[model samples]
Target: MQFCDDCGSLMHADGDEMVCSSCGARVPKDRERAAQFVSTEKQTFDDVIESSEEAADEGLPSTEATCEECGHDRAWYTIKQTASADEPPTRFFKCQECGHRWRGYN
Candidate 1:
């Protein structure tokens, strides 16, 4: 990850040199420094465990919001900033009885 010395643009690796994408400037890559970035081992995510359906909803807080689909008065809720930072965050609700999901804007 090298930048152009003249125009401060991001540079990409060419055959033996780093070329600037924006300004077209080229710089010779140091062989010793470039070799340090090379990897020999293959990466794997075999140890990762996916969350179960019950475990996914365990941490959510519950509220008295009504479910439009099943008329349930209780629901599990989570707040997220779906809009811009200047606007209020949205409230997402999942019905405890029917597993129906809905969103409410603040």
Candidate 2:
């Protein structure tokens, strides 16, 4: 990555010259092999949680499954990729009342 010689901002490859979008400075023939190591490796979880306003507007699918904690008759359910690709997806359920979470392997 090349930096702007005028404003010291990051420069990108634009054909033969490195062009700075900040101050419009062009550094010619200084195409150094710079690896822009942006951290895209982020850990993501499959926890299906929704806000109350979104749930009220979109309306999550409710099941007749009872909550073990508060004995709520309805729950919001979603299928999640919890295991290997050869295996089946797990079903995650959350209680609407008590917000209890549980999963079932299919």
| Distance from true location, Cα of 14 in model 2, Å | 21
The whole-model lDDT of each prediction reads 0.85, 0.74
User: What TM-score would each prediction reach against the true structure?
Assistant: 0.50, 0.46
Which residue pairs come into collision in candidate 2?
none
TM-score of 1: 0.50
Q: Candidate 1: global Cα-lDDT? A: 0.85
RMSD of each: 5.7, 11.4
Worst 10 residues of 2 by lDDT: 31-40
TM-score of candidate 2 versus the correct structure, residues matched by position: 0.46
On residues 1-106, what C-alpha lDDT tens digit does candidate 1 reach at each position?
6779999998878788889999899999978878766432456767755567666775779999889999999999999998889999999999988899999997
Residue 21 C-alpha lDDT in model 1: 99
